[model samples]
Target: MTIKSGIICYIIGIASAIAQPNPDRPDLCQGAYFTEEEGAKALQTFASTYHDKASWEARASLIRKGIREGMQLPARPQFAPLKPIRHSLRTMDGYTVENVAFESLPGLFVTGNLYRPINATGKAAGILCPHGHAPNQDARFLEQAQQRCATLARMGAVVFVYDMLGYGDSKQCDHKISKALTLQALNGIRSLDFLTSLPEVDTTRIGVSGESGGGTQTFLLTALDSRVKVSVPVVMVSSYFFGGCVCESGMPIHKRPTHQASNVELAALAAPRPMLLISDGKDWTRHTPEVEFPYVQNIYGYYGAKDRVKNVHLPNEGHDYGPSKRAAAYRFLAEYLKLDLNRVLKDGKIDETPNKILTPTDLQVFTSEHPRPADAVVGDEAVLALLN
Candidate 1:
């Protein structure tokens, strides 16, 4: 019943996340398995047995990876903080917008766009928009979210889109790796907080979905915040074992050390909650059924939501989400979180046809209202105060 066992999962480096039977003898990443039983246990161990700052401090590789490769933000004393501001858009349907700004870490910030759903007379479904590993570089963020938002807007759901820390306008003017990642998650969580705070948002109906690095953020944020009702982690999840010591060298999301909860355990967290895992039927990385499918399925089985868990395999598609692929993702969300299955389900959205997603536009989300320096460390205190 434990998620980790004093193991090598993210929270704890117990190393037991994988059953390292012959550690002294041999067997490294190649021999590891990421199952709910093992992963959940590992996570639990990290929380209970490995609550030492020294344990985290000793992992220099992890700390450096956290600081250099990704976005960071200052932490809020509250779980996370989200604010609502008014907005007007031409493309957006309902356009009940808000300007959400909060302190992620101490000196870091994560802020960006927020698009509300249409027909929101009362509390409505909410979502967090975390961008990809490299923002505009990823098609899903470049066009997918905007499309999805409009699609949902048409259906009358409240959606929020915020740039991931370091990806959009959310980058820190300071440099602190560990704190940055922590606040990045906090940023997403804060967005969730803001959603619940809204009189128009249905806190219980909130959902989160992300592609690539955003996919990782989806899982991590959902896992930490129980308030997130539904989630779809696309193009990334289980199969890490494959990318790690298998067919290819593990160039993981954010290039972290890769000992977090595997996709298997990640799915398990969605137990009763609805979860959608989208993968390119023809993925470039080792995210195929032979690699990660079984582990994720196993996690779902543990939840008794094996039926609730689903994956839309896009045939011959590389790493990106198109209208067709995105449709499948939306269906899963509408069915589980929105309860609008009858109205929101679109047939061609999840088309299995292999098509490239929209290329990102060269538009920047941050503006002078809250500007940042070119190369700020995530941990800088001054950098953290910009959004606040």
Candidate 2:
């Protein structure tokens, strides 16, 4: 069943009232808070508030400020040097993969693999690949993640596939911290710092793509950072559904006493920039074509760049970054980032056969030989202390 359609039904089944936030609690918009009718009405109310570019930008500024303050982000966040550690270069079909780790904060390590073209000669586009809450913590090791990164590298873009907080080698603390949303956003910025630091990377041609929770990360990062030139968030944008995880909506980014927001508005913050929304019939994003897309397109209309924001809806597909989803992302990224899609095409079709799938052990960044830093903080409380 589609998420929004069943929200009230599910609540009734549990003998509970409709989902509503208690006034005493922080106004965190989670899961399906609105039915189709309510969501459309909310969009209408939002639209009526902003008539043109000037008003929309003013609203956008408030939304951005709400996000920063809600997340309790520092007025001036000090960034430490991303002391990177790299090794394990494995050459495959048209790309080379290297296991990498870098400090996003003092003693906090972000781990992943860096994929690059086998023989890159000039400035190439850089793509950041973040994963959702897949079965195992080792999301970057998943077949779909590997396939997309390798395919993009083969297409001549340097790709970095990194782990979310408690996933894979980023195990210094649990992923359920109160500040989970804040840390993940910071990690994304640092990932860009690391990606652009490469001598071969083109700073002007940066892009990001992911699915599910990763999709939430993709648009959130793109909205906050101007460096992201292209964004393809798969199966995660919804007007009624604010992400279910602490990492996505743990903070009060969507609601405060003075203002309110939704993922539809947040995603639209990528105004005039190239953004592709990938949705399916089985999840919260099922209403994309009707409910969300039109609202975002209207925002883009203010910039006279409505064509830049596009939606690819799959009525037959569910929520996953499978081959079909990857194909759509590939086409969009290539068109905007100037990547060579022909390299991954065979028989005039996208072929992912060239991407190598490796075991979790093979992609692990911390081992006995290359241990995690001794000074790394442990547990949720200790990590929170560092933020203070």
Candidate 3:
């Protein structure tokens, strides 16, 4: 009878097209406010029972996958830094944004945006901001990249934000699905070179952040490269498997990562550094943080930097980080990177925070440019230079 029940639960979960709540941890109660730990545990239960596309293994891999790989090794050859792609200066925040480009393979250039702050006495600490999937004009790379880049500048730090190749204004002509993901990963690594190359940048104190797809790249890049001193991956990490309707809405059935890179393992990459995951309580994909953070938190705890990894959840937001969450993420970045805000603000950094009205009503000014921002803006600051 008990075996039958487990089978029933799994079947029901599959039928629902969403994870069914774990009968074991009824206390963590789905769709309601849950303590981070409870959510983590409950999500684990759900991941094991559901068919989340290798969900259980992804969670397990987090704790064990990279034991042999060691830290700071060169990334997969596909994403290893190669020749410089192209570098240009584009306009953003009403000032020039340094655009860095690199070719992942032939006919493929991954571009990104770099923000240089004011009052740099020497090479300053830097941050790399990756964009989420929202038809990239670069504004949506991560809603807060621009604001944080500006803030970091004001605080006397250098920052770089680039659009992922396929998403923004890069001159790439093809959007074949698999190639895009590989290029996205390569762009993350090349971006590290871009930040370190800047004259006004510190290069050592670099950080990275992103949400959804961008957030996925943030941690992956941070893991592959040690230059990142801090990282905040909002809504990107997930139970390597499991299907949340809200989370899986647009996932291409064939294109997702095949192996699990658990939060535990990703945290291991940033073992001594600071890492944070901001999640939404109602989102279905919240399970990744749920199953991964507890174990990953322990890893950080073992390193005596337990406080470094924070799991912040918003009570009433969707998958993306809204204003309050973005603000919190910015604070986390500022505090960890130790940006010298007082100095930059006094003198003015990187062109007085470019403010042009963006459509979608709520889009704010963010400064990550991979290739360049999209040329056509429909509602505010609209331009068509790229197309012509």
Candidate 4:
């Protein structure tokens, strides 16, 4: 087919896919809250409300409030004292990985691995690495996740790779249950607190990045928390698709009676602050360059930080946190967080070989021998009650 014909066929296929529902996975490209046309119009309407910095701040405040109310977030609780527990500390070529766990809520434990440079002297920059829904049923132990964290750490940033609710060691609740949006957002905030609490971490230099579903978490946290100085949400943010997963759009975040917003607006709330939107042609983000990027760039323009915002669209790549995606994020983070990129680069390319990808068992924070904490919330009901 000719390029023009190919583009036409792709649009026709998407329309057909939208018309037919897949019983096995109903939410795929569902665009439940708004159609592509409607979403585009909504973004335009939201952007129209902001002209100057003062107007943009007012709009941002309204959007943030809408998110909190729509997600049904409870009062911000004192981040339960980060009684962090560190298990295995494995030293790598230029960094080290510490198997770590901490409580985001009273009984809800957030688990993951913390990576740090071995030759650190004073305070260092910090990065939060949330993972996409990969390894299918399991979310951790992905080589890509490990490699990114390792590379960032070797380049002088303390990185934390955390589990998403039920994934990995955080098996207290099911991944698809209700209140996930609220719980995960809280966990992210607590994760930020944990990262910054470390005396070795500089408070001003902090960042968050993730792909796919994790990208949802990345922007959500960045939108809600000002502590996140830099953000790179990959293969996710789309003007059309709010997010297929419940965790991303399960709540009423996109639909308030008085106002409506999409992930694009949620992401744009990180305006003026440095952010990198990485999209690929194989997924919903295919139109990001033409659609989402311009909308967000206009928002940054309000603060005169348009140059600080960037969009790296890969027409040939698919919807995964592959090497190219990580490279874009690595360069952005290195520049924004002031990390030593030279340490992670060789021959003008990121060297992934330095990372020692550990097995899932090796990275788990709660195992049979170590056992989950006695106070850890046991089932979904119990965990949900904590939020209620």
Best by TM-score: 2
Q: Compose the digit string of candidate 1's lDDT tens values, residues 1-388.
A: 0122101112221122243322442222322344434534544543342323344333323533342333333333443232233322333333444444444433344455556554556566777766454313222245456666555654556777676544555545321232444546566776776667768777778888876556767876776577988888776664433122111112222234444433444444555577777776433223445445554454455445668767677756645555665777777777766545444444733322221222223233445643453433454455445434
Off by over 4 Å in 1: 1-91, 94-99, 135-141, 174-179, 241-261, 281-291, 339-388
Q: Assess candidate 2 and give its TM-score to the true structure.
A: 0.94
lDDT of 2 by residue, 67-155 (tens): 88888877666666899999888999999999999987787888999999988778999999998875446667877789999999999
For every candidate in turn, the CA RMSD to the true structure comes to: 11.0, 4.1, 12.1, 5.2
The C-alpha TM-scores of every prediction are 0.64, 0.94, 0.62, 0.91
**lDDT tens per residue, model 3, 92-158:** 4423345455544333445555556433566667777776544334443333555555555555566
| Cand. 3 TM to true fold | 0.62
Q: Return the top candidate by lDDT.
A: 2
* Model 2 residue-pair collision total: 0
CA lDDT of each candidate? 0.50, 0.85, 0.51, 0.83
The segments of candidate 2 whose C-alpha lies over 4 angstroms from its true place after superposition are 1-26
lDDT of 4: 0.83
